[model samples]
Target: MADEPVLPTLPKTPFNGLGSKRAWAQANAPPPPSVSTSSDPAVFSSDDDPALEAYESARRHKRRYVGTWYDQHLALSSDSVMGDDGSSTIVGSSPVVYRPQRRAKGAVRQQKRQFRKLDSGVYMGGQDSTDTEGDVPSPYTPKYFVSPAQLRVSPRSLPQVSEAESAARDKIKNCVEYGNQEVDLSGLGLNSISAETIAPIADIAPIPLVVKGVSFEQADPDIKVYLYNNHLKDFPLSLVNIEPLTFLTLRNNDLTEIPTCIGKLKNLKTLNLAQNKLKYLPAEIRRLMGDGGKLVMLHTASNPWWTAEKLSFQAVIEQSDPNPLIRTPVEFLDSNGQIYSRFRLPLSDADLAESTSSLELEVEHPSELEMPKEVSYAEGDHVRLLNPTGARSLFEYALKALTKLPEPELEEVDYWLGVDEGYPKGLRETLNLAADAHRSGGLTCSVCGRGMVVPLTRWVEFHKTAGTIRVDRESLVPFLKVGCSWKCVPARQVVPECEEKLPESDD
Candidate 1:
């Protein structure tokens, strides 16, 4: 067997000698020399050639950094790098730590002096130059870090107008005119002068002649004269001839009667006298006339006279031969003397005819009338005759006789029926037609003439126990029966037992 030799390992060092040797060789290597050829023209010559020199000079004049060594390797100048065009590329460089520059001794002293002035409360920077020496001291406390000479304001003074100037400013106080019309009352105590016044002040003007808590004893002649001539419902005339009267209103006055001498005033119009206590009107009030003899419009609603029976003030104005100038309340008087004030009252021909017929019937008949029953009555059936013709005629004669009798001796008709008072005139004709239909053979029973034999066409079987019998299209249920004396015994008399066992043929 043969033995082999091993290679030795190198010791580690801060710089590898192999790497250092390679780097040194690369740094010392010389650049390749340029070639020169005369036949290839001056563009191909080396730097030593004279023609190459001329070409190099021309190239240096025309050459640019476009795709050249400057574009690839040269760093941008600081002036170009800081330009605002934003196209300058920033190259990374090693960052150096920055240190602030030290201030000069004079500048440091000046800063220290300002801080000392501020700290000592000798600051003057914030105060106005024109501020007086006697002005209030600022409330700020100085700080140790600041100079006492540095001035700063704690509370500032605000500009303000003088009290005398503020008081002299003019403002609106009261109204002097309304709707551009002057309020005139020279004859009254009101001043004739015009001035601008507030609206509330203008509205508070006093009214004329307002008396409170006073009663009248036999109304004064002046008051009556003022009332009639001025068309006033109630006017107080303690001393009536007073002047400067333009408007008068006496609403809700408790005036029970009017004076006759009230037609004297010739200068009055537009009086209001609503809600008074007047029942009857004075005849002298009708004489209220103007310069052309036309009556003035009067307003007297809500008075007791409005609902009076005799001499309706409203009706008198409505039925006057010449319509007066007064505004009368329009009321439609019904047949019963009721008044309806609606503009379009519901009135029809049927209602008028019914009212007229009712009046005529009341006059002809003295008692009320009942409606006729649909059930037919047999002859001698002892039925109660409602509003019979004989009874009505007798009542009318008795009523006439009673009218002639003295009040003390006249006897009242105790047996008088109250059913005939409102019967119509043709009721007897209807009764006669009903009687004829009942008498016809179409509804006669062979066993008992009183018991009607209703035809099959007129019979309506309402139930097994109850049926409706019709005669001439009128139907009735027989609730009451009138027994014939020849067929049945009377209630007071009883037949023998043998008599009760009648044959079925006899039923």
Candidate 2:
């Protein structure tokens, strides 16, 4: 309580009627001036009031209301306050000042690009260009193709050697010396060698040599030759100069004849001339029958001469009388009755004549002379006889008479008795004499032994006793002095004894 505080009294002003500062400003500020025209109604003008004109002008500039009247009014009211004049002014204190923001700077822009092309009308980058015109590559090469002129050039050739040089080279390489004494021509490559070249080599040494698959015209004669698989037509006699040759083979050649000098080789044991063209043998081959007859074997099969007709080897073989050293195949047979065994010797003209004479003698007197009937003779069935004696004539005549008589019966003597009566008186007297001699000489029937009669009952019975009838002086008188009537002997009774003494008779 001491000295109680006294409050100050507030003063009334013209702005006292406003509620806020913004309201106070609006009340004290001058009103806006009206727009006028001739056609418009009469209204309040700023010319009629100067203070309103200044206030309206300030408001257009966005100024605040700070006139002298507003200050005085604020001084009278103690609630209205004012700040020091020298301090920073507030933003709303002056409405005429303005502040603007700056715009941001725009981004920087880029420029357009360009390119170049080559003279060949080909587009290229700056990094790919080069300086040369032929620098552009092709897919294939142009120089590999061949031209027509290059193909026309001629080629060089080597020289050829002569035949002499070829022969010399072949001899040096293929010829071999045997035992340092002789050269062997076997398997020597002499394909195109001439005869002149071969002759000199053969003359140097006379040794055994074999030449195959070459012509004989190309071979030398001085060499001891053995030929195989060769074409030789004819061999000359000069080949025989190879003396002391033991064996020779001319198989499968074209030789048609053998040289006569072949017989001169006494040392030759075997000779083979198979598959040749010979048609006949030479006479010189007969001389090969050496001392003791030393020709051993000869093989001449497959030759044309062996199979030739009419020219037989059998005639020659029979004359030769060969030893057993020679052989012929089983198919060969001496049908001509000439060949005996081995050798082929021909018959001489004289020997054949003598044989003919002997054969004629046998057929003329067949009962007296014995000869083989199987063997054919020069004289056939018709044969002549020389100096046929009574004995011979009677023997033949009796056979003729017996054959002419009629056949007799076994029981009777009718035909025989008739024959005896018709006989001549001389024959009848001889028959009586012959019968007396036969009975006195003890001549009897061979089967019954009763005293046999001349001109017996049957001729067969008379023939049986003829062997006992002797042909002595007495017997011959009966037969020759008077014609005999005794019939001839039967063949069966006389065959055995007659066959021993004379040649056999067919009848």
Candidate 3:
């Protein structure tokens, strides 16, 4: 605040045109210094120095390339430069004397850009004037790897042997070489056992024989065989040849049917047929049971024993007693000779009326009422007689009639009465003897317990029996019975003395 400072003002010019400031600056500039030939370091340098000449040459080249647009236009006016003598001037190493290419009218000029590729698959440079011409970079060849071919073989060229068969062969070889008494072939998944594989071990007691100078001892008389948990569909008949075999087990297999010849195994003491797909067994199986039978241990658990036919609720309720005091329906029998109506309660009068109203009573199908009479063997029925409807011959009739006679009278009549007319005396005597034998050892009827030379009716049924083993769940070991006869008689609980008890074990 001490007295306002006086500011210096800019000098003014009389001319105020656009170039007035530029002209004033040129006129007021400082004068150039005068040249001198003295060897002063700041003012002069040696003219003959190579470094000085190179620097001058570089400065002249930079000036020539950086010419203004007007200079470049004049230099590129024609394809060749014309001299004062009207002759073309040849271009030298100087770039300014060369004429530029002329573009067609309305054509655009594109700047060529040069790019350098690095080892890292990247472009590193911007647009430049580098020419990419006749040198084509040797067409970059890509590299890859190829694998060698593998050998192929056909299945027909190899031996036709399965893994199971190979294993079975190995087992048989070991048994023969070591004289094994017990041949355990369990869980080998064998679908079948060839005769050749089972024949050597099937002998009762093989004799000592010399093979390849090696004497082989006889096998044990009481050989055992175990074929459990396999894929056997039928009993191996080859095993029947093992006369002295005492123990045989075939548990947990896919056996659908066993051969009747299995009864020929008179010495077999233990047998296991559990957890198989057997729907029913042959009647000859009885020969393996009872007191006189050989089998002491018989396992038949976990089989899918067939179930009885189901009875409708209407049939059960209709057969029920109408009396209110009874409180339950009477025991009713079905075609299967079983009583399944015991579990259902007797319907009340009101409920019975309601159910009856819903039933179509006016219409009755004739086809339903008329049952099929031409009896044909059902599925799973194992027929013993080929001709179920064949008429009996006179000799067979006479033999059947003799079954009704008393034992003393039947013994007295040793020959057929009138049925042996045209046969020879020896044949007649043989027939007469057969008739007497049939009368003496005739089968009894299953229904009425009457002695029969030829049974009029026969059926197979699975009956429930107690087992030594315990099982989980409320399993229905149902021994259902079915009777097609009009007189419905349920199966009696009558166990014959022979089959009532299991045979005494030798152990």
Candidate 4:
């Protein structure tokens, strides 16, 4: 009778009509062990009990979640609308409280739909969905930089620096050097590098010098600067500091506007600004279009804002491309027997080879840019020279030279009369060079030591071949009304070649 164990009783709610199956299962469950057994809590009342060790081993040591769920009965206040569409959802603007209520089956659910009306039928959804497809951002608007900022590397997530960068840092310790005049750096365009900190070389070279982005504000007067593909928006004023820059490559950039200060680059010969987002040119930039009678070869074709008239006037040089002027006027060719697309001085094949070979050595290394204390000018150096204009600026000197020349003749010189009416072949060729120089830009007259003036040039025009620029004619231009004052520039005459007949084109 003592070994017959009593069964556990089932709860009243579980044994009710709808839950009787669950209650029956509980009623047939095994009975608890006798109170004195090791499994019973009564025997493990104190730590001294042997059963307490087993209980401690089975207990969980981790912290348990102690938070409560939002109450199912709670609600926010909201307004309702009756319409053809029998469904309702939650709206976010101006929330209102809703009371709990019993509803019949198949009734439209009265859930709130958070929405903002942007247009007639368009609504911006909230809470349950995102509102990313709205028309707030337009295409032309500057796209905000969406990448993470990297001012400095975190100590915990430091990236391994390649051995080459470390070696360049070692070699690039001193930025200032004067031996060969070059600044070459590679793999230094990363976040941690800066021009000032990396080296003291602020003097830019007139040749190719590849380095990381450097501060141009205090840069030296460099030329032939290649800054293409820099993803730039604003043209740096530092570039304005490069006073005598000749060949500047600003291709493939996001340039919107150019400053009038760009007119300062007086000696700039070739300006390559293809593939830019330019809308308009500054009026002062007209100084680049041979306005001051300075020869400026331009390549501004791909600019979106360039009009057809302006593009037609764009100048291309023979040194770069043979056919810079794609289209030719038939009248100009019809007048002369010329069949060439562009005007260029014919060079012997040996001379062409020499020029190409020199270009290869033009790219100077950064280590070679250390300037020498006494910079020596190369031989055969010929720049515009004046008699005695003391401490004059480059532009001022040029102005003085132009004004000092003699006035041209008043009578118009017929181009065809001199060539067809049996004038000396040597004289016709000389006039052609003078016309070329007058059209291109100024080259000082060898005799007068004066620069060419506009409308009526007093300085003699000369051949632009790889030899003598101007022969003779030296005087100061005093404001005078002049026209082709053909005081023929006296110089040694070149041997004339027989003119060839033009080959007819098929109509």
Candidate 5:
């Protein structure tokens, strides 16, 4: 075989990487001829030329680009012409129709858009600054009718009362007389008392006191209210307004709970609350204890109480053994045999959801909606706050500021000293209302025993005793406990012997 002949090689071009051969050819091509700017119409109106005819036909089919507003107006007006036969015909090319790009998902029209300028030095397009069509009515009207009077809410009316209720109300209205030291309203078979039923007492003026079978005629005497053996389920919170009440009896009723407003009774001495269905006492009841308190006697016996065993059933626990022996109150047992209060609040998830829904309907603020939730424990079984953030409200802040002031300053401002003391008219009334909104100036921490306007840690404890108030040996009453901070609340776990003390012999 003959040896392969050597093939001639073509020189590489610098623009070879330009991709398309047409682009490279166009880059090396010469410029096109310029059009003749002639005034002769006969030179351009040659019908025999097919290239000119093809160009004209293409130009007629294609829309012309209108660069300016004036150009667009001129092209639109000149594109059509009236023929001799009284018929309209398109004479020139039509101007381009503007089509905007599709907007993004949530894109909104610009409120203040820039106006487009015309060739005649005038702004041509944009929305007007004012809403000119605001008063214009729609062409189509809605068929449904809604009355303006129907939208107006009427005042809520009181519930219908039965004949027994009417008789009880009339009796309660006339029970208290002027200068009378005692108001007996027991054995009425009344289920509840309203503000209207207790309104007549407010009209009684203070008169000279004259007691029978006694040598002394006092100028004034405090009132004693007796409502024993009634079917009252709730304590009459309206009685907190009565400043002169010294003695009160609500024994043998179906009272399940007492309001924290009971602490407002600064002048109350003896209170009989026996034979009721009370399982817990508000922490505000502590205000009625000690020498400063006027309450000398408090009867809280024969009520179904929340004991350790009862509370332990509502607790959440975790254990490795399947059949673990659950302890009462579910807290560590100390060497002294005293158990720390670490029981979960007896509130179910359904109850919490219902309460939250109700609050959402009634309350407007988000902070107000944050009602107390559940509590959890940390790694060492120490109680930790799951909800209820340590946030102070505006009212709490104001109350805290007023409490921090010195006694002399408080007195100088004519601040209402006690519940019996009349709140001074004007600016002091606001302070009085603010202070009364939170009875005894807010809550008291159980651990540190310090007054707090806003509690940082809130928990429930089944206590055996309520201050110095004596009860039956088997009774275990629930008490609401709070702390200024988590640090103040004691941990549940018992301290290990090693952590408590150093190794004695090894040392």
Candidate 6:
């Protein structure tokens, strides 16, 4: 029985001692062309068994060919924590979260995308690097930043009135200075024989005697004196000897006439002679008023001077408005400093809006509006700014935009210099907002020719970081690949230099 089934003698392999040769033949032979992957796979149709489908759906969807590798490679402990009530614990320094992979059905994914090949060698895409510099940040992307362009710095001033000023005021015999600066002139009981407020300290003047904070001792005399709001009557004859006076103020005081010696101040640059009792100005003083331009400014408002003096300064005063909205004392000061009261300045944008709303009412009942009777309350700076023909400020521009007003001129690029040099904060904000609204869409989309709406919040930040056109917001936005939306911005088109043309070999 044992020798009955002794068939053909098989080839002597190392596995001959083993019972079976079928295993050897099967192992030695080539593999089949294909295999069935769906042999015992759990292929549950959603309609077949909703309960099992739901159970499987709640489970994490493992990525093909990658999940097992990550599971084997990542040797962390299965130490997930749960709360007492079977909820995920939310507290702890190292709270571990196991998020499920959510995927859409019937989606196709690229295999082996994590791997990449380069000239040097194959590597993981995460670790793949090139010899060139790193990628640049996009300019249009919203970044958290702002420019100091909107901010206005204040001008430097003395902390308090100097001891010299206090002592000078103390030298007066009759008047007492109050906190509110209110004076009871009747209580002083002094007769109306007015004397000069500024008098010589001693019988004879020293070479450089300082009076009202002006020291005559320094040569190339700098008349950096601000003698406004004083009770001075007569002109100091000593001022006539000075070769050239750069500045002089005879404003807000009681003066009868301009001394003939004022002509001797050949270099009298700025002369503020407003709110004075001068009935007449000398012919020589007229000559000293620069040829409109040579004298940058000459303020002579609220003066009882004859029409000739007012007429001479009127032209120069108007020219002082280099940019209309930005004003100076010379530009804003009218015949009786009445312009400020007439063209009202609002405290804020809201105030401006309210003021603009009231304009129609004022026009309807001009007689009912109480007008300013005198210029007694006017400060040295009368008006904040004069309006452009169309829009004056941000609030005005917004209001005018509703009326379909054409875009007005914007502040010059260098206008920021004025901001840095202490332009009003409110005005700066208004100017910045107006500029943003006006120049918002000057730049076109990268893909389309339609203008881009630059985000004002991040406009300056984008301008600052944009390597190609990192200039002011206005000049910068145009060059950037900006757009109305993300869709409009063209994809970054990288053009590699084609070194296709090679020179002939000259061996």
* Candidate with better TM-score, 2 vs 4: 4
For this target, which candidate reaches the highest TM-score against the unseen true structure?
A: 5
| Cα lDDT, all candidates | 0.25, 0.29, 0.40, 0.31, 0.45, 0.30
Q: All candidates' TM-scores?
A: 0.18, 0.23, 0.33, 0.24, 0.42, 0.20
lDDT of 4 by residue, 200-310 (tens): 333533233456795434334444555565555655444555455566666676776565456566766666666777645443343344355243454554665522232
Where does candidate 6 have its weakest 10-residue lDDT segment? 103-112
Which prediction has the highest lDDT against the true structure? 5
Q: Write the per-residue lDDT of candidate 2 for residues 108-181, one digit (tens) a residue.
A: 00000000110221211111111111211222312321111122111111123345435443452343232111
Worst 10 residues of 4 by lDDT: 70-79
lDDT by residue (1-507, candidate 1, tens digit) is 246664353232222232221222331223112111111332211122233334433432221223322221111111121221112122112111112212222233333343333222212111011121111122231221111222221111111333322221111121112221122221221111112221222232222333576543432112111122122233333212322222234445555544322333333343444455554343223333324212344455565442212212221122132421122122222212232222111123343233321111122222211111212224333333222112223433333344344422321121122235555444333233223223221122112323221110111010011112111112111111112211221122222232233222321
Candidate 5 residue-wise lDDT, 35-65, digit = tens:
1111122122122223333443333222233
Q: Residue pairs in steric clash, candidate 2?
A: 316-344, 316-345, 316-346, 317-343, 317-344, 317-345, 370-503
Error at 328, model 1, angstroms: 17
Which prediction has more favorable TM-score, 1 or 5?
A: 5
Off by over 4 Å in 2: 1-224, 292-297, 306-507
* Runs off by more than 4 Å, candidate 4: 1-222, 291-295, 306-507
Residues 153-263 of candidate 3: C-alpha lDDT, one tens digit per residue: 122222245677568778867776676667888889988776566787764354455688676765447778889988887777678777777888899888865654565
TM-score of 3: 0.33
Candidate 6 residue pairs that clash = 208-217, 325-386
Better of 5 and 6 by lDDT: 5
